[model samples]
Target chain A: MSILDSIRTALRAIAANRLRSGLTALGLVIGVASVIVLIAVGQGAQQGVQERIRGLGSDLIFVKPAAQTDRSTGARGAQGGGITLTAADADAITEAKIPGVVGIAPQLSFNAQAIAQSQNLGVTIIGTTPSYADVRDARVAQGAFIGADDIDRRSLTIVLGSAVAASLFPDGDAIGQQVRIALGPQGFNFRVLGVMEPRGGTGEQDNYAFIPVSSLSARFQFLRNPRGDISVNQINIRTAPGAKQEPIETAITDVLAQRHQVVTPDFTVQSQNDLVGAAAEVSRTLSILLGSIAGISLIVGGIGTMNIMLVSVTERTREIGIRRAVGARGTDVMRQFVTEAIVLSLVGGLIGTGIGVGVAMGIDGRDISGTAMQTAIQTWSIVLAFGVALLVGLISGSYPAFRAARLDPILALRSE
Target chain B: MIHLENVEKVYRTEAGEVRALDGVSLDVQAGEFIAIMGSSGSGKSTMMNIIGLLDDPTAGTYTLDGADVSKLDDDTRSKLRGRLFGFVFQSYNLVPRMTAVEQVELPLLYQRGTNRRAMALEALDRVGLADRASHQPNQLSGGQQQRVAIARSLVVHPNVILADEPTGALDTRTSEEVMGIFGNLAREQRITVVVVTHESNIADFTNRTVRMRDGLIISDERRLQVIPSSASSPDASIPVSEVGS
Candidate 1:
């Protein structure tokens, strides 16, 4: 006498109940696929942050006013620490000619409405030297950037960011056009100098306008300090390629501290590498959150699998008895039932993988929520998801399989 | 050959203990065709189950081919049952949606053998069901379904065939047809055959009849055979003690 292998018997049994089996596997398919898709999105957000940071320019140090924690008057102390760095401080750092300092650019910034033709949009107005373009990697894609003569003459010339250019001048001929930079009803007109090259990602860099600091002081007289110095927002220092940011940052800080004549400097210095590290830490946390939520769905899918298996056992009670009558042992019956369950989950896992991969590929470069969506598919995620599916099959299927094996042959044989 | 020594079977229920079989002892040599006759609740089916090794006697020793099988483990007993006995039931007990050959392949499916399909076909041929090998139980007549079940029993080449109410579901003609197959199996294959039934006419087909009542064997009678075979000198009457405690 010869019997088909346990797996074959299980396949036949599953085939016999095609609708039920298919429905049972549907839960697993959705669970696994959602896991892959959601993780891809989360990882994509992380990748987006890392890419934006890398695009922020390398070997650079940022000097900004420190947020002071004053127990006496906390909120007003924050206002006091604001705008401590000025254009004169930037001039001091540059004139010092500290070794390895490639370029120096200080910025005075404000959010205002920029209007051209019939179009007007809220944009960040950045007042800085022509060196701001070089130190910040803001390449000119059109005619030219703000010239040194523009800073000396305090000319009302503007270099539009990629997004601002596209918005203010749909004709793409903004090199000689006039755009109105306004603070409410009071406004000033500036000539368009050039459009900066397009930077990917929906970041502030691509939505800003650059102008001369002298022009900023000329237009807004109230912004000048008592010493007639132009107060700047932040200073960006670019170092030579492959140069360390620490020594360059210390030199710039010392120069500024001497210029300000303060014992404890009222500024904080941060490197680009520091920001990148913080972004990575954030991504790790996001991945864990995404992974656990998906895992719960998979467990729910496993419970669905167990439910059907138990029902199948009860439905086939007489079949079990018939097998026993024909000399099948308890283990043999258990093996057959367990094989069916594993087949269900593994098959579901395989299909889920295919669908997940296909979906991740399909939406990689899609634009969702005004930003390009990027997906990074990790191979380990696929392997781990499939492994968990196999485990779920074994755990959930165990009780039902043992129950089938332990059925009383006499009673089972008598069941209709 | 099969032996049961003073077997007693008790079933525990919520109400009380019910003794299905009380001090019943019986023996049959190889290749004997015997019938167990009794009314409902007379324990004929219980005796068949014990003899077929599908169940154990509550308080007795059941020896099969000189082995004390009462103490055998479940797996070991299952293997012995597959190797030693072929079972047929009144309902045919064929797995649904399976063809005749597939049903015949059931018993052999538990054993390790080759040419399973050919062997199944051969068993079908024994029951004159070779032409119906691919027909499912639902597609066949009641008599044909029973024949297919008989073929399933024969596929494993078992030494003994124990049938419980094998023809209870059949018409008179089909009953005769099914019993004829059992008789031929006993005579031609030299297999020991036992059938449990309540009908006296059904018992007439067997060479010996064991009449049971109230969980006791009332009489054991041997019929005079037209074609004499076996040890003709047999016990005329086997006494069974009263069932009461």
Candidate 2:
């Protein structure tokens, strides 16, 4: 039979039994829809993580002090005490002769409480050089960030996080206002200079304040040795644009290794590329896992299709016999039944795709706190799901179609 | 022309094998109107089903138009059935929801590349049912449904029409009208008509009658004269006296 005739016959048969066909197609619809929605969510999460990583400059490298080797256990940082980096290390890096080296900053962090108009808020305070903002890719929304003059003069000026500024000064100006910083036994007053833009807030780095390194060292003398020995907590390095990050990272690692004498590769050296790559790997695995789970539904839907097709074959035995007696070949009967099954599954798949996309979009539009869950519907996933549905239809419908084709016309006609 | 040479059909059941048609042989010439008469359980229906290609013989050879039909495959048999023969059943077997024209057009659908509507109308006109072309089977009388079945059988222009008790459900008056249509088809179209019936009076309408008993042909005879119509009967003048009794 021609394709048009097969379609007409399939449509007529389906129309003759509308309720059964609809129920059978429902399984496939749900399966395909879930696959699309779940994968979309997974894709959205993956893209969000990638974007966050990219927002932190891809060539930015973070170097932390290596754990100290114990004299007894020979294990590095066995009890959480490690070798400390110093300001001299930062100077060595600034003075290092290396191409693609743009800017470097030494950092020290402390937890402190600040009092403004009898309202006290506990916040993390970061002490760094004036170049910290440039290396970290941080932008100031109001007023100006810390300048070299503040560091030189040892000025008591601070930059506020967006959240901290909003909390301390609800309706008034935060810049040029005095805020009292209370430590163990001493309290110093500092003026707010600027407010940082809102980066991602779920991390410890986003809810901190920035202050001049010289002022922090001078005020908190207990945190350093009396001989002016400063212990640097971390070093942030930014590479030149369009420069290969691996070579620059290796060059920095060599410099740090020579200065710290850490020949065992113990120090932790990480870049934005490494973090993004790890996140992408995790996202890919998650996508596959979700896809497989949804694929189970498709299999169940396929089984439903097969079961219904077998029932249809039995129900239409007389009709099959009549058509065969009228000159329909076994191949033609097989094609007709299989066509009906595929049509049902394909229609279900399309409906499911539409529903899945709509649901994903709805979720993306909602207000979720903290970690933003983003969903992007990929074209490849839709095509893959549709193709799988067609395959399921073909595989599920084959057995029943073949059975219908092989029926003995004489015996079938004799069937009441 | 059709010939059956010692055709044997045995059906296996839970009790035992039942020989439906045991070594039955017969010959039928073209344009001959014949009736196979038998009582119940005489294998007459089995013979009709085999002749209609609805079943196959277990053994022996059957030929139609000198071609061996017993050896043909299911597809070839279906093609032969469409081209060489048409069937009518005792129940009229007009699709219940179909109109008379659609009922008659059914058989022609099996014949490849035929102008179905024209042939259906021509056949309906031949059976004198053209006026009721749009009437459903239930709307028509028993005789009219039988006439529609006859028209369905004739629409394909088959060389032979096999009808199993075509007038079995009709009254005596309606049966005669249905028999008149068959007689006209056989006479005007020169098509062979074979019928199976238990009613001896119905057999009188055919040109030849073959009687069967215990799955075998017992007697075969040809009627030399056609029966006259009831309008011309001598009882037509005296019908008023019999109506009171």
Candidate 3:
């Protein structure tokens, strides 16, 4: 018989048992949909990490002292093992004139309470140089940030982060207003200089108040270490536009090691690109792991298709006899059953792709457990899913089709 | 023309070898209407299967239209069967989901260079079921279903029609109606017709009857064609040579 005639015959048979066919296809639909959704979610998470890294500037790097333990209670470096990084070290790194180095800011933070009028709130007081704004991607929304003159004169001028400014001055502006900040047993009044633009994410910089390192050193004597050194907890570095951070990182590490006179310096220097690359790699692995787990279901769906096809062959023994009696070849019978399987999977694949994409889009940009998830359904993933469905159909249908083709016409005819 | 010489079929089951056909020889000419009469296990069906090319004889020489087809392969035998013979079964063997027209068009699918739909319709018309072309097997009566099977056999324009108990499941009136269509095809269209049955009354309608018992032909005789008049009224009466009754 002609191939088209065989396909038409198979279609008629499939239509005869519509509910069974739909149920068989449902397994494949769920299989492909799960694969698509998981991959999209994984890809979205990777993209989210990249965007966050871009927001912090790609060429930026952070240097932190290994001895600086205990984040909430400020640097406990002296108790841990004695302080290593200081304001002088930060100056030496900048004055060494490292290539690709655009700016550097030394940072020291302490938890304190700010009282404005009758309103009192606890906040982290971040002491840094004027270069902190550029290095940390912090933009001043209201007034100016702490300038060089503010540091040189050891002025009591401060910049408020968006959240801190919102909480302390809920009714009006906090610029040029006096606020008393108590550090340990001493209280000092500082004037607000500017309010920073909101940076949305889970970062310590988002809930802090910015001040000059010189002001913190001169005004807060209790912030010093036991060895009388002004210990800086972290140092932020910015590279020039289009500059490579790898070579600069190596150079900075070499300079710090040489200046410290220690063979194994107790600090860590990490570029923003390194962080982004690591996160992306982790997400790609997760995507494959999840996709493969869902792929098992697709195979199970194929098995279901095979099982149904075998049942169909058994049920249609007399029909097979009829076709053979009508002079249909063995190949014709085989083609008919195989074509039916492919059609079933093709239809199921299409439906699954639609549902998967719809679900992915519905959950895009939604927050799940404090992390805003982003889902992106790629075209290649859909194509791959559809291809897998077709393959599964062919593989699963082969045995049944072979069995149908090999049926003895005489015996089949004799069967009721 | 069909010829079988010393045809023997031995089926090997777990019980042992059962000789279904033993040294049976038969010949049929074109345009001949013949009946093979035998009880169950009398080898009439085995002989029919051998002649129909659906089974290979253990020892035999079968020639159809000047070609030896007994030793042909599965694919070649299928092709030869499509071109040379049409089959009708006692159960009517109509595919459940297909309409009468589609069932009739089935054999034509295996034969190349044929106008399928038009030929199928014409075949249905010839069986006197032109109005029921769209009816499924379930919707048709037993007699109508047999007619559809007859139409399917006729659509391929084969040289011979091989029927196995064609009216075994039908009432006496329906059986007569089905036999009327076969009589018309053999006489008017010059087609050879073979029917295997255990009923003597059913054998009476054919021009010849061959009775089998225990895998051997016990008797073969010629008879006058007894075409029922009222059921096949639309077909013009054809000349039949009267022989020994």
Could you give candidate 1's per-residue lDDT for residues B37-100 as a string of tens digits?
A: 9999998889988887788889988888888887777898788888888888888888887789
**What's the distance in Å from true for residue A40, model 3?**
0.8
Error of 2 at B99 (Å): 8.3
Pairs of colliding residues, candidate 2: none
Please provide, for model 2 over A1-416, each residue's C-alpha lDDT reduced to its tens digit, 9 standing for 90 to 100.
56765776677677668899888888888888888888998888888778878866657877777667877987656321453666777788788966887999888777899888867888888888889889988889898899999988889999988878877888758999988888789778999999888776344455678888878878886667455856667778888887778887888778878977867654667777888999999999998888899899989999999999999999788667655544466787899999999888888888988887888788884557764567888888788888888899888889999999899765665466
CA deviation > 4 Å runs, candidate 2: A64-89, A107-126, A149-156, A162-172, A179-190, A197-208, A213-234, A367-372, B10-18, B30-46, B87-155, B161-187, B190-245
CAPRI quality level assigned to candidate 1 from its DockQ score:
medium
Task: Give per-residue CA lDDT, model 3, range A17-75, as digits (tens).
Answer: 99999988888898888788888988887787777777776578877776656679875
RMSD of each: 5.0, 5.4, 4.6
TM-scores, all candidates, are 0.89, 0.80, 0.89
Candidate 2, true inter-chain contacts retained: 0.18
* TM-score of predicted structure 1, chain A: 0.89
Kindly list the per-residue Cα lDDT of model 1 for residues A27-143, writing each as its tens digit. 788778767876887788788888888888887888888766667766545533577888888888889999999899999888999999999989999999999988998899998
